[model samples]
Target: MDQVKTSIENGVLTVTVPKVEVKKPDVKPIQITGKPTLSTNFEEVTWAKLKSAICAIFLKQPDSCDLEKLYQAVSDLCIYKMAGNLYQRIEMECEAHISTALQSLVGQSPYLVVFLSLVERCWQDLCDQILMIQGISLYLDRTYVKQTANVRSLWDMGLQLFH
Candidate 1:
C-alpha cells in the first residue's frame, strides 16, 4: 500500500512519497517498519545487545531490525533502572543517541533546509523509538517531569537531547 510517484516536467523532477491516510474514528497505529512487532522476552536483552542494535539502526545498516523488540527491551530496563534509582544511566544513554545522531549530520552542505530537516529528523527518530515506551516511565514522567511546571515532559526530554 506504500508507494512513490515521480513526475518530470522540463528539468525538474517531482517525487511524491505517499503518507498513511487515516479514516474518521478509526485511526491506524503508527507503522514504523514492515516488521512492526518485537518479541517482548527481555530476559536476554542486555545493554550491550541493545547498544549494538541501536548503533546498527543509527548507522543505517541494510539489515532489517525489529524495533518493537528494541523498544520492549528498553522498556524493561526502564522499569528496573528508572525505578531502582539509576536515572543517570538512562540519561547517559539518551545523550549518547543524540550525540551519535548529530555526528552523522556533519559534512553535509550548509543549507538551511537540510539543517532544519536533520534537526527535526533527529528529534523525530528519538521520539518514535522511545516515546512508545512512555508507559514504562509514565509515572516518572507524571511525577518528576510533569509535576514541575517548567520541566520538560519525557517526550521533550528526548528532543532536548538533540539540542
Candidate 2:
C-alpha cells in the first residue's frame, strides 16, 4: 500500500512519502535545418586562407593559424562537391612547396655529407607538413579521395610530390 505521512511538532513540519521509482520522460528533440550553401567565391576565398595555413605549416609555424577552422574549411569544400578542384589546388601548393624546398639543396652538392643531411631534414620536414595537412583534410581524404578512382590519398600524394 502506498502511504504518505505528515507531522508537525514545535512549529516544524515533517513529511515522509513511500518509496517509489519515478521514470523520466524521454523526449529528445533534434533541430533540423536545410542545407547551407556557400557563395560562389567561397571556395576561392577559403582556399586562399588554407594556402596561407599550408604556408605556415611549411614554415614550421603551424601555431600561427587556427587549425580547427582550416579543417572546417576543407570539410565544407568537400561537402559542397568541390573536392576535385580543392585537391588540385592542394596538389599545386604541395608541388610548389616541394620545388621551393628542393631549390635550397641545389648548391650544397659540393659537400656530400652536408647535402645528404639537408636532404634528410627536408624530407622529414615535408613528411611532418604532410601529416599536418592530412589531419586538416581528413574528411577530404576519407570521403572524396577514397571514393574517387585514380585519386591518391593526401599522404600518398604528398609523398609522391618528392618522387
Candidate 3:
C-alpha cells in the first residue's frame, strides 16, 4: 500500500500521494441512427388534408374542419423537418384565396360605396379565416417560423397575402 506524505513549507501545505494502477471501464461506441423513415407519400397525404381544411375554412365552413387532427398534422410535419414544405403550401393556398377574392370584385356595381363595402367585407373575412388557420398551425409558427430566418409569422403572412 502506498502512503500519502504531507508537509508544510513557508506556510503552504503540500500533499503527495502515491499512484496506483486504475483500470478504466470499457465504453462501447453507440451507433448513431438517422431519423425515423417517413413514407414518401406521408407529406402529400398530410398536405392534402391540410389544404382541404384550409379551403373549407376560407369558404366559411370551418365546422367541417377537424381542428385537432389538423393541429397534430402540423406538429408532425414540423417534427419531421417538413415545416418549409408546410409553410409553402399554406402560402400558396392563401395566395389562391386572395386572388379569387380580388377577382370576385372585378365586375361589381361601379358605385364607390358598394365597392368600398365589398372590399371591407372581404378584408374582414380574410382576417377571420386567417385567425382560425393560425390557431390550428400555432405549433409550426412557434417552433419552425420563429427559428427560421426570413419566414414570416402566420399573422404577418396572412396580412401580406391580403395586401
- Which candidate should be chosen as best, given lDDT against the real structure? 3
> What lDDT tens digits, residue by residue, belong to model 3 across residues 44-130?
999989999999988877555579999999999999989998999999998999889989988797999999999999999999989
Question: What lDDT does each candidate get?
Answer: 0.60, 0.91, 0.91
**TM value for model 3:** 0.75
Residue 66 of model 2 has an lDDT of 85
**Cα-based lDDT at residue 38, candidate 2:** 71
**lDDT ranking, best first:** 3, 2, 1
Scored against the true structure, residue 94 in model 3 reaches a CA lDDT of: 88
lDDT of 2 by residue, 84-145 (tens): 99999999999999889999889977888988999999999999999999999999999999
Model 2 residue runs over 4 Å out of place are 1-35, 62-64
Candidate 2 matches the true fold with a TM-score of 0.78
How far off is residue 144 in model 1, in Å? Answer: 6.4
